[model samples]
Target: MTNATRISATLPPDLAAFLDEYQETHHLSSRSAALAEAVRALRDQNLQEAYQELGEAQRSGQETYPDDNLDGLENE
Candidate 1:
């Protein structure tokens, strides 16, 4: 298991209430679990954006690949 860290923050009444309701509805153990999941989701989004940018750069010829292995294949 990965190491865990504890953090504390204050939220507005409405946000606090929403989180409470979400925990009850989803049966989450604690706020930390919910927040951790949220952070993981955000990280995934960032990684996806980075991958998209790399693809765009490659398409625009801003990136290059050397053809070191000249393998022959028949195109049907």
Candidate 2:
């Protein structure tokens, strides 16, 4: 099943131009595809940062992970 939603967004001229350039440089089928790729990269980067924080917290001997219980993780 495809999970696609349509939405409208307004971008400033410079950003709009950049988006066009990005779209052209990447040879994407459409602006939506370029934006999707950018968003996916941003999401992956954010996840990596969050995971790094979690690992640091675990190694630092911090007592709690508010969003995680550290359950089922074998000792290093």
Query: Best by lDDT, which number?
Result: 2
Tens-place lDDT per residue, model 1, 1-76, is: 1676777879899987887887778888988777666666787787677678767888998854346622222221
Q: Pick the candidate with the highest TM-score.
A: 2
Candidate 1 versus the native: TM-score?
Answer: 0.68
Task: TM-score each candidate.
Answer: 0.68, 0.76
What does the lDDT read for residue 35 in candidate 2?
82
- Candidate 1, 22: how far from true, in Å? 2.3
lDDT of 2 at 53: 88
For candidate 2, give the lDDT of residue 1: 11
How well does candidate 1 score on lDDT at residue 61? 82
Assess the local accuracy of residue 4 in candidate 2 as a C-alpha lDDT between 0 and 100. 80
CA lDDT of each prediction against the hidden true structure: 0.70, 0.80
Model 2 misplacement above 4 A: 63-76
lDDT of 2 by residue, 15-70 (tens): 98998999999899899998888877887787678788888998999855776544
